[model samples]
Target: MSPLLWAVGSLLLLSLVYVAPKGATYILIDDNLDTELAPPFVLLQEGKALDYRSTTVVERLMNGLPRNALRPGLQPLVGLMALLDPLPAYLLHELLVRLAGLVGMYLLLRRYGLPGARHATLCAALALAWAVLPTYTAYGASVLGQPWVVLALLNLRLGPGRWSDWLVLVGFALWSSLVLTGVFVLAAAGMVLVWDASRHRRVAWRPVLGVGLLALGYLLVEYPLVYSLLIERQFVSHRVEFDYAQLAPGGVGAGLIGAVRYFGLGQYHAGLFLRAAPLLAAGLALAYVPAGPARRRLVQWLAFSLSILGVVALFCGFYPQLIGVAQRLLPLLRAFNLSRIHFLTPLLWFGVLVLSLRRLPAGWLPLGLVGLQLLIGLSMNPEWTLNVRRLLGRLPATEPTYAAYVAPELFARVQQAIRARTGQRPAQYRVACLGFPPAVASLNGFYTLDAYQNNYPLSYKRQFRPLMAAELAKSPALQTYFDAWGNRCYLFSAELGKNFRVAAFPAQVVHEWAFDAQAFRRLGGRYVLSAARLQHPERSGLQLLESRTAPGAYWRIWVYQVRN
Candidate 1:
């Protein structure tokens, strides 16, 4: 088959794979709440961009950064979504981005000198199949920067010999740096440049210098912005201290083993069938290939892959003891997800495998493997598709037929209750959820004090910690309870709720105290929505205004007026 036909075929297949399982409703993992749902909602409602630093309540309370610290790469897409309905726009956007990434991957493979046209086509098809596997689907949809990161990596491999290439690189670099994953792409590009220089025995000064200056300029401007919003505000409440005991079983070796297993194979049940044997075989065969661009590229990728995996394992495994020494020496490493390092691993593994198989005939071998992977992905789709269906309430999961997870009927009832009781707009009142997931409230377009996000301002935590302490002090059982739970438990209490805007205490603390109605009123909470019976609801002075079950009688939403 011609390369064009191959490209079109792969695009169609992957598009179907992506769209089939997705609904015109939110997917509830990772940044679905913060990045996917809230930002676009805020942009449409307020006619401005919202990101980690901007949409956050503490940032708003402090009037901290005048602008969002996040890059505006996703703004254009978000703007377009605002013009249409969010659910349809999100599904369409996901389809297009995945398609674009696939095309870019094919082009990158072709440029990497993967021998014949047929070989390149087959390799690209395999890579595309691998890319859309269930393991990555959730992230691909929720994370805005992913497709751009793929395109940026492609440009990195293709190099910046041309003026246009340089321009594209700079543009993508600037745009991508808004997402933390983009930073890793830039780092990978730097490694590529270093490898090129080492291979050629001379510096590629122009691109090297160009990347350096651009990065330095970005950091100069963005560092203060991030530091102010994140570091200075103590939003790094999620910073994890490395613990050696958690690594157990085998210490560093066990950590490395777990990282390799989870990162490479993924956590999904389908991933049990998606073994690493073929990819590992390809990697091992890299040693036998003759010295050339393909071999050199494979070597560079392998080294890059191992380096990322090793760094994460070493830091997480040895933790506070050994890793703390490194953290003191290099402070920036303090705030990072060791597991996220795996985000790039599958792609790199695909590169190594595809390049290694370039010499084989473009026939059944690649096609069979691709088909098997696709089948595995399809098998997993039913559960996800069912979930989307359940969430969207039997509505067609298509464009122009979007529905929020909170049924329109239920939402209207809740709104009516609040309006009747408060004589104010829903957005005017700071709302909290007692037993329901916070996202449900946020999805219904309420200005909920409850949220689920990564970072929270330290000020909010400090303000709230006293209430928690008071509660714990009142209940010796609670103090004993947390003492059993440990330090990581306390971190969530300090950070997660305040950052996410959830009004209730952290799970570890919630069971210990009766709901403090006076504390809720003091914190400016005017409404409390509960899915379960509230503890000491009378003491909290919460008046139940309305109660009704959601669609399918799954759970009841109880709206209460917080009597000041």
Candidate 2:
């Protein structure tokens, strides 16, 4: 098929197989809710882009905004979706981003001199694999800007021969920095430059100049914000640590095994590296192939892959305990999970495999492998298909919940109860969820006292540490509400009834032991909602106004008006 036809066909297939299955609208939950939905909602609805910085308890206690230095570049994309209803807008944004990555990947392969048909087929195979790959799909739906970052890196590798090329390169570099993934771009570009220089026995001035300009641009854009945040210690302090067992040789080995399982060549397995021996051998053989362009491309791919792994290894080796016993001290590492970078591993292997396969009789093996990968990916991991089907099925319903993280009917009922009880406008008063997820309150636009985010302010740390210590002293059961960092709260759990001390509240009011009604009121919370039954509904000055089970939900929502 012609390139145009191939492009069109692949685009359609991807949209149908991946994007459309998720439907036009779906609820965001967990990290997706916080990063993609809440922040964007704040920016679009309230015109307060920085509000997310202070939404967390620690951030608010700090008296100033927490440093939200990352992902500032996503504001425009979020803003563009303002007019469209949220679900469609989010779905559209995700689709377009993935499509851009696909196109960029194709162009990148072509730039390396891969033939048209071969590159197109590879692109299609990638799309197929990505459609069912949970990690890639999750990241794509997130606001992390990973896909755009990949696209930017591809553009950077195209080399800046024209003035427009230079403009695009610089623009993307600045944008990448704003999104906080500039580190990867910088690392990749720097590695390529060094490799090129070493090969030619001379400096590659253009790339060096480009790198300098990019760094200058990033500094100009982000340094001030970071500096101020560091001074206040308002930046996110969560340290991501990997078990030493999960690093490179072990983790990579497991991933290879998982990939083999994904190809249906082996039995289902848990470790990522189970059947990865042959695949690794194939990749290694390709890495040493004699074709000039293929060798160069393989070297570049290997360098990029190693650079990412090296960073992870350095973190695991240097800072095994992301945050030591002293909770006050900030962690050296910010991004917690290095495993997310493993998303690039498949692409790296694919690149090398394609180059190595170029010399083979090219009709069936590539197509067969692609088919096997897709089949195994879908068959072994049924959630991909199930999730897509659920999303699509829920779209026609009045309010569809994603993974049941937030029940739309329950959320609406809670919002109504709050409005009726408070006799105030929506979003006017702070709220707390005793035996429910904070997202339940947050999804309805209430400022929640029980909230969590990566960035917690120092003031909050100081304030909450003592309070948490006091509470834990009173009832050790409260330990369940606090994370290892002791800076965030998690009240929602199946064992909440067992873990929370009910007697902590003045009235027989439902309590999670982490916060009493007084503390709730102190934090400007006027209402406390519990999913579990309260021992004394009318005790402790809290008026139980509504106790009703939400339709289609198992738990009952008990809404209380806290007394002043």
Candidate 3:
């Protein structure tokens, strides 16, 4: 098949793969379901997407989560949620991100790595594999648009670039997060410029200007972050108290092991799959291939990419220790995760795959490698894997369909029942969740005192911490997780541990519920929505309000009202 045909075919297949599940079955947990969906939905629903006031807040989560804490509403992907329902909007988002990746990888390969029609099929195949990588859709174009950024940089560096190259950088800044992706991308670009300057013995002003433009774009797009961080410091961020030592993987020995693992497999958050095996095999194979210009170019590219990964992996492994020293001088170093440089590695690994495969004798060998990568990438996707498992009649009971996850009917019933019993609207009283994410309730229009927010007021964290203080005291790990890193300021149970997706069938009961009723009430927390049944209800000053279950509901929500 031709390159264009292959590209079109892969996109159509992806549409089927993602959209076929629709509401019945798809991933609605972790970052996508629990955290990301609610923010955009709330912003658009309340007509607060464009609200740029410093006081602008979404009352759905973290007890008045700042608008800046959520993704910017102006971005095209976020705006899609305003036009369409969550499912369609999200599917479109997935398609758009993958499409960006496909085009970006193909363009990068054609322009820099593999030029000419002879290499088109190989380029398409490699690009197809990259697009299929199971990255978090919530990240939008951050992971996927990386190749485009690199292409733009190379264009500016090599020659007088087209206006299209500038457009690529601007579009990237608009779609991607400054903290999650922008910082690292700019830093990587700067490092490359330094490397280039050393080789050429002079600074290339054009690419430097390109990098400056990209940075300026990020500043404009993510102005809220700039406002919060620099312009007007509203409240202390919970990240200020981030204890790197406790969060890091044990001592120096474990850190070294982590570095080695990172060098091989890459980080899980960055489209991680069967990266190490194929890349390693290809590199080893390339070493023994007959020496030529093609072989030399492949070797040089592989060495350079691998070296970057090695340095990044080592830095990440001992990040905690490095931060410890740095924080003593500049305390904010604790909040900044320098390890996000690993986000760039997945694209580099794919580049390695392309370079190595391009050097091989064309046919089944290259095709097989691409095929292997595609299968692995698809298998790693939660939505795809779940659907595959369901099709094969082997899906686990614990796994929930997207409909079951966002059960509007179930939540509506719960909402109506609460109103009938208490004569109070959802906005009148705050809710806290146990053995489940507070985001579930928040998305259902409940005012939750607890949430899984990336950024929020440090005062809120302190206020919420007291309610679960006793529970934290039970487990040292939980104590560190809450006290040090308190992003998930939910009502934690010692018995439930970290299992947020509680199944109703097994009826997981918490024997000892250590909760402070006064503290909860002080935070205006009138309702406690729990998945687990408490052994002694009165012990926590919670009276069971209602316990409801339905056919397709993920949780058998037991509503408990605090005794006044």
Candidate 4:
């Protein structure tokens, strides 16, 4: 290996291994860990029978059937990684990320060799920029399939070496939903290759056949998502707006952790460069030089086009639909469901910059480019922040505390009560509980049936509320309980005679998949039953069992046995 490339490799590895690890921590309590994302999918795999949206899709694929379910609101993305093991896909995806990085770097650089070292160096710079970004890698990395988009980019740039390259692109689409929007970045690039081959009069059949094959492959692979989105979009109003006024810089200070979330973690950090200005400058400056052959003129053209379409496509897909709400570009810019869609923006910029700097002498282009990136990043500095300090001060393990706060420690107590009454035979019970943070995971351990969130925030319409209220009225004793969607039945804490601003309804939210503005409402549980039931005691064939109490600030359980 050449010394220059070897030196570049070492630098990349050291920055990711040493500097990156020191600045980040992945445990809960930081608010950004987003761990709840994976539990349900893994829960199903652990033999519990239930499904979230992603899990539903994957389940259908594995079980060989199409689902007719339609869910409302944003759902968690954790189901994919959760299907494998006990530990909720944490370390597994990190390993995949590291592996993708290695593969991305090797293939990316190899492809760059044709363009010569200077341009190749620029492509290398995209790695460093995205690696440090918060949305791109920081919180986003906690997600398992996060790196495949960039990995797919690497393969697309590899210029169709083996037939396996096409398979990799298809594989990436299956693994993560984030790539769904940005995938056209690849589809567009592939179409260009077909165009170029036909223009050059070379092995033209490959490009034509590849595009046809790619189109058909994506059609088959994305059938579920395509079908779901098409039908869903037609009936319900996603209310997604893209009113362009939010592009202006606003009060995105320390408390607003989501400010640069759209810009990618690397770009986010780089955006506030006064602290690491010099270091970031070094990274960006070093990003513009590519190494390799002069025959890559065609490939370079394709990269440049992709770089443009990628930026435009990202803006169009999300921002245009989000204009009225925050009027913010950063939020809309997240091409995927998460906020890190801007990670590759720097990649495109670096590509053009590398092309520009390819002719410069040793060290000259690198220094100039780095300085430029810092100047631009510092331009958006959001008044100094305490975000870093707050992050460090969070509790080491927040899952346990959050668990206790959301549900009572009823496992051992419930197990004992059931065993004493029924000779310890765990039956296929059809148990039900109010949906909360920990109910589904906690209940399936000893209950009759699987647990799930009844629906809210996503599909909370005015008509649905009365039906739910009627159910609550029929079961007055369950006033303090959670309903099918896991909402409170109003006896414990009624809605206090008001509708929520977000939803404009008389409903309450227990949990949401992602941040929906409508979720920040006052949750209420009221029964639509006859006033007779509320005033008089209802007789039942139920008998009292051992009611073991749990001491906690959250759930208050009152257990009984039915002679059904």
In angstroms, give how far residue 194 of model 2 lies from its true place: 2.3
RMSD of each: 6.9, 7.4, 2.1, 11.8
Off by over 4 Å in 1: 1-26, 29-35, 50-77, 134-160, 174-179, 209-257, 266-277, 280-333, 359-361, 376-404, 466-513, 539-541, 550-554
| lDDT pick, better of 1 and 2 | 1
Question: TM-score, each model?
Answer: 0.72, 0.70, 0.95, 0.48
CA lDDT for candidate 4: 0.35
Best by TM-score, which number?
3
Clashing pairs in 3: none
Tens digits of per-residue lDDT, candidate 2, 1-564, equal: 755446546545645533432232233333454334544444445454443343322222122234353234243345445767455666565555455445545555555525566556655564444333333222332212333334444445555455554554555544343332455556666887788778889875765766677666665545534554555444444322213222223344554554433332321111122223225435644644777886677667656654544454444333323323222253333334332333334444445445444543456655565566555555544334544565456333322344233455666777776667556764566665665555445555666665544454444444444423544545443443343343245433333533322211222333433335565566566766776555664544476777755554433567777765
Best by lDDT: 3
| Candidate 2 global TM-score | 0.70
**Please, what are the lDDT tens digits per residue for candidate 4 over residues 1-564?**
643364346434533322212223232322212223323433453433333233343221111112312221122233434355322343344334434543454345445522455444444453333233222222222222233334444454445545575565555444433232335444555666666667776644544454455455545444534445554532221112212323323332421333333322333421223223323432443343354554256346545544453454445345423443443545433223322344344444444444444444557545456445534442332211122322445422222233343232554566566667666533333232222222322322432211222212223332223423533454443322332213321212132221111111222332211111111111111111110111111122223354333553223333434323
Name the candidate, 1 or 4, with the larger lDDT value. 1
Report, for every candidate in turn, its global Cα lDDT versus the true structure.
0.49, 0.47, 0.81, 0.35
119 in model 4: Cα distance from truth in Å?
Answer: 8.6
Q: Per-residue lDDT for 1-564 in model 1, tens only?
A: 766467557656544523432243334333343334554454455444543343333222112212342234243356556776555565565565456556555655566636455566565665466445554332332222333344444454456555555454454444333334445555766887888889989876766665665466455435534555556553434333323232234455665676565545544422222435345446445755678997787677667755655565454444434544566676555455343444454555555456456644456765665565556554454434544454556633321122334345666678877677668886566776654445555556676554444343434444444434654566554444333222212212222232222322222123333455666667667777765444445654676676765442234566777665
Q: What lDDT would candidate 2 get against the real structure?
A: 0.47
- Residue 151 displacement (Å), model 1: 7.6
Scored against the true structure, residue 310 in model 4 reaches a CA lDDT of 48
